[model samples]
Target: MHLARGAVFSLLLATGLALPGSEGSKHHANKARSAGYALKEPPLTTPWTDKVGTEPWPEYPRPLLQRSEWKNLNGVWKYQNASGLNAVQNPPFGQALAQDVLIPSCLESGLSGVQADWALYSWFSTSFEVSSSWKGEKVLLNFGAVDYEATVFVNGKKTGFHRGGYFRFALDVTEHLVFNKQNELLVFVHDPTDDGDYVIPIGKQTLRPSHIFYTPCSGIWQTVWLEAAPVNHITQLDIDGNMNGQVNITVHSSAKDAPAEAEVTVHKDGKVLATHNGPTNKPFQFTVPSPKLWSPNSPNLYNVTVKLDKDEVESYTGFRTISRGKVDGIERPLLNGEFIFMFGTLDQGYWPDGLYTPPTREAMVYDLQVLKKLGFNMVRKHIKVEPELFYQACDELGLLVIQDMPSLRPSQSKHVENCKSVPILPDEKQQAEFTRQLDVLVNQFKSFPSIATWVIYNEGWGQITDYYPEFGLTDRVRQLDPTRLVDSTTGWHDHGAGDFSDNHHYANPQCGTPFYSADSSPFDPSRIGFQGEFGGIGNNVSIEHLWKNQAAIDSINRTYEIDTTIEAWNYRSHILLGELEEQIRLFSCSGGVWTQTTDVEGEVNGLVTYDRRLARTDEKQWQADIKALYDAAAARSNATTATL
Candidate 1:
């Protein structure tokens, strides 16, 4: 039933009578819009949202591997919503679309100009022309990501299809292009985050969101563009290095001509350091002279250029070593073969205006820059997989990352039950799909030097706890990438696997130490430990700083804490860090991750406000406290023994 405006809609709004589940509620929302009710004003926008003009992310999307002359197709496109029986199959080929949505922005984002509640099936159409200079080059269409699934049509011919939602994919559309004249391009997308008959990996997304979980972003949420490439082009670059500056490089290429010849060059400060000539699709080794090691203080990086036949791509890498061993009888992780305590905050990567997509690149980089300025050396990028540039920023800024694999799970309630210590085992099909997704995630992200650890599962969200070790996920990850540390289970349900022993606690966390196994084995002094998550202190800001959405406001009303003023919150945080300082004595705790980097949705527990317009803490004080914590950690590492 379509809802009419004025009295009828006002009654529904006043009574808070929403439809049952996600499917019914979203269909109702679309119907309500069709009957003519103006969109609600955006709750809050970032500092960079206003700067996003016609072409929001005009900068080249691929930072690590860049080409000279690819077209950036990020602007307004004609769109239409269709959710009936066969909507996905029916293409509105030459027909006019009723609405406009900004490409690269998700359906629910205000920046898209649609702000839809949900769109399970939708159509997007646009027109473009092949560059005149490229007469016979292959036209490649690329998408950084499309929510769940997408099918592409160029000039009324099916080009390709993709399923995974967290990585990049491309298609060769040379066969379908019209070349000299304007070519028509159409896309059909389907995303069943939590509404349809099937479910996928959802990182804290919900239809009726609570304080922490938030509304999901649907449809295209990243950059999309077209590139011209030669027949034999370089596809990927994998670069790795060690303490002695022995750099290893591998060039993956689309070599129709087998054994394509290639060349690799290394540079620092625009001066040549080393060079190597080799064949495509094989490892090539070289050495940098008198290497200046990469660290949080120095952040040294070396630029690299690769050429394969008629193709060339530029990239970068850094030199460092990460390992774990007994420092003085207690095991601890060492960076550059030396003990350096890892300190960071949990970053969720959510935005008020763009949802999954950041308002702009500058806004996205600001979070990492702020944390670095506050004296943090690391961050645990929880659950969600970010775009490649995020990792590039970490590599350049000298911030270590503990990356997480996105989890597939069931629906959530008002609060997390069981302290998030239990796992709901999936059946054979779900388990298989999970493994497939995990494979794609690891294969795409293994080359970055900033990633120090890979978390296989978090808080038992998607683990088959009883059969975890037997299932061989830990073993699989170990085989996939043997260079980095693996975390089998982050918070709980530790089944005697992985490298580190981790736990989570709130309010006062120094109460006790976590055991390494589920059978409660005595603390193993030979293993490293970390406080994966802790200290969720809340500091309430004024309404202008809070997210303006009604659902978020309601959650804030229900979950906001007593530290209402900045002075009170600072005192509370000071006392909490004092507790953590004491925790360093037990289990040889080498690191701590504060609950989050910034306020997200209605979770008013951040050092800064949701809009990033207000900082609730003194920056200098945070830096000093962090320095003192590192001092204490250094002292702890020197101890000959520690109490369990």
Candidate 2:
């Protein structure tokens, strides 16, 4: 299969194709040579940057609810940043697009190959022919996510419109389908991204990114695909792990009338363990004799199959229960009626090349793999909702997650200011939208067993008032999902609601730190104690891959110079571990979460780099340290529970 360099070039050119190295070889070579020695600036790429070729992010975006027949609408598509006159109401489908950009990845990301700033309007046009095999089935166009607002068109007809950037949405394009004929799929996007007057949740995105905030990501940032399903099909599946060797399942069907009777089967290793027949759009409980409990040590997940008429869907769920119980007079998170210390890092899930989107499926899996390998049991997905795949990965890998609702119009000054109280309030419109978004978020992610906690607000970022007369946000979350615990607000400006008393500390945490540590017994009796965030030990990797902002870089380089090398970073990790052990021993604290899992743009306070290049501590040493911490904590729990 191999050929000579010249022969390969000749053959490719003869076959009306350009060789891999011939298209932009010279430019790449020049860039590589100029990266370090000759050039003043470093290369804006990671080791996996070049891996994003042709069809990037080709994995099935939704693993929880999977379908066999689907088309991956990822890869290069005609794109144009609609500015000035180009920002039209309708898409220019017939005309040649100004440029080509990769789908799924946002326009601002390097993987898209169109690193453009956030545009007020943008258009994406692509043509697809309906598969002859999917003739009778209903065609559904699914979008993993589209930032702020998106208007989708099919064959010159407006199909649907969607708002919000973090959750999945779908459109039924069966009506607009033309059999065998090529159909034009067009999408128009508009995102204000924290700059607009409307208060929309932007997570950590900022117009002028500095310190903790990152560059704004706009447009389609997740996968776009088409799936075929029977008219009467399973729309949603919600599973709640019960204590009595059973799981409560609710199946939402698409049919309006009493849906056909559905059959549910639970299996492990192709061996059927349990079965039940229930009507669609109803809740059913199934029990497994001697059910295997799912935990960090043994993540036993059972495959589930649902069949209704011609529709069949496959899913998986873990049998586990999460609740609060007292351990040594301190309220702690209990899994399966046993006290388990929550040990995790703050997973922001950002990337160097792919801003909100991951470069590839493997890249996304790799981050979770690293976390699992490091022997951590949980991850607080800080402030941003990730694609379902991230939660699925956590489910499969047995990592508990505390999901944070992305904040809107976060005031950094208010967050950091020393104030006992302030009349923080959101406009009527903004408040309504925020409440709606939170409901959407809860409904979107309520199925996953790995999500042990729902973090309603963080650091008083978007939390306006202590109470909402018409059922508060945290109360709403509890009502939506009573299965999991809720951290109403993580740091300051606690609404005095939710299950956990959460707090945050920075730099170096020691004993006698108020709210950060207990130092004395008999802490707040109302809620479980948890240090939601602490230990931001920053360590720089290669300056070549640093963020473009020199001022931000300089600021980070100056402030966090203490942990310059891996050795120093390991020392810091040990120091943090010692502090955690102290918190577990003397404080009788329920849980603790490290500052972050990876370095973000313009912020070096992460266990690993943004590109996932370097780790602050050696894998073996870190895992061993974490394992010891867990064992010690578990032993303490056993001793405390024995007396009870």
Candidate 3:
């Protein structure tokens, strides 16, 4: 593994609450003293080990809006770190001394082959020869995601720069292609982590790795690829369904004022439910009486086919309504004409080995499937944006999501006050970076059907003292996709502007009496009560898997006992689970999402381990308990309706 020259020193300077000195220093010291030195190299175990490819991440990245013709450009790439300003220069290519790292995986990840210590800025270059199939077709270069900021070049020609790291960006490179000759693709990435104020929700990332925080991940961390498309191809599609069961469809194209027509057909059980035709700009509405609503239990979906002349694209849509209305004289979230409680986990979607990238497409799908199996109907995706395929799997497998806008640089005043508990950007420049990234995140995933809620801020991380300005972030999301609900704040320090009164309570799941009072009160949970984050149960199954470098069996047992009994419970893993079930039973909870889905780095409070091989809690027992709570809530709602 190649360690970045200055990373260890920089990490030493940036260590916050963790032990003095850099993690690398601690790791090296521990390695020297240990007697069980089986080999010279560190253990090569990551979430992506079994799935690494010479040409990595070969799956079709975009499944929601797909095309039949494309090429996969994910594999080893020539890499070097350069100053962000000087990255435009053409670096020496194909040199062995220069680093060779795997594509779609970050430098910090084990699967990258070159496990360099994380760097702030880097350049990646790769070459491919165009096929002689068709010379006139448009070639598009696509990036699933790149952290913080990235710039793309084709054969030394500057193409474009994208600011956000969590969203997809593409450039049409057909005009710049030199057919039948070797062409080069160069990418420059700049990720400040917490050093600068950027809207990257460096959620668990800190210079210090302890408790819930983790090691920083920077640079090009997602898939990079190239595809061929028709000159006048479909760029994007927006599908909106009304409460009246009428669906509005709009197709966007690069070709202007072309005589483009859209033929939309909805099918269920191999039978055509409805069909309609209209111009590209116009809305195509189709109605079905007593519509089959989409829910976690049934997840009824209608297949939608859109044909424009010779080009035909197929996708799916769900008929469901999410709104706020009065229930028992209090405003609460209504899902599909009924008050359904949402129980879920805060899914940061990070892996120990892969960092941001999953080992394989199946690995990504497995997380969502396991959540479903554990009886969770919803997932608050934390403060990170996932690939479209992750959301697509949620749609297909029947899961709800509360997508968060990645955190921005926190204000200095708020930063100082919350420094002990939260992660904040160290400077104002970082805040600007955070805003640009947030805009990109909102635009990219706004169209997904499974995403029912948008979270603007998590706790006080990256939050300003007066968070109303941050509500502008919520306003932007509302304008982009008004169909879904928005939570201005996920946890404490509420702005009281968005749809839910989100709260984070650990150990105890009780919503304060003042929060539920109908009388004049500041924090009223009855109005819009949602347990945004709670539960952090840590159950360490094996001593060998512990992150600590110390190898003594006795020390492992002592540490595990202290970490699990008091610290994990104090973090409220057991208490929150019990209280969460009770709150749903009492009919006071609208919906709730726990602190996390899996163990991340030093945070051992996840429901499952980082590798996702084991569950912390008894799965069958939890599922039965959750189902009982859900059933009780449903019965209460039914009885209230009967009285009406």
> Against the true structure, whose TM-score is highest?
1
- Model 1 steric clash total: 1
Candidate 1 lDDT over 259-340, as tens digits, reads 8778888897878988889878887787887788887777788888888777778888788887787776666778888887
Backbone clashes in model 2, listed as residue pairs: none
Model 2 bad stretches (over 4 Å): 1-43, 84-88, 412-425, 466-471, 510-523, 557-561, 640-644
| Candidate 3: tens digits of C-alpha lDDT, residues 446-474 | 65678888887777667765435567767
Better of 1 and 2 by TM-score: 1
In model 3, pairs of residues that clash are 146-165, 196-430, 197-430, 197-431, 198-430, 198-434, 199-433, 199-434, 507-572, 515-525
Taking the tens digit of each residue's C-alpha lDDT, what string does model 2 give over 209-295? Answer: 777887778888888888899988777887776556687887787895865788888888978988898877777887977768888
Q: RMSD in angstroms, all models?
A: 8.4, 9.3, 9.4
Q: Per-prediction count of colliding residue pairs?
A: 1, 0, 10
- Winner on TM-score between 2 and 3 is 2
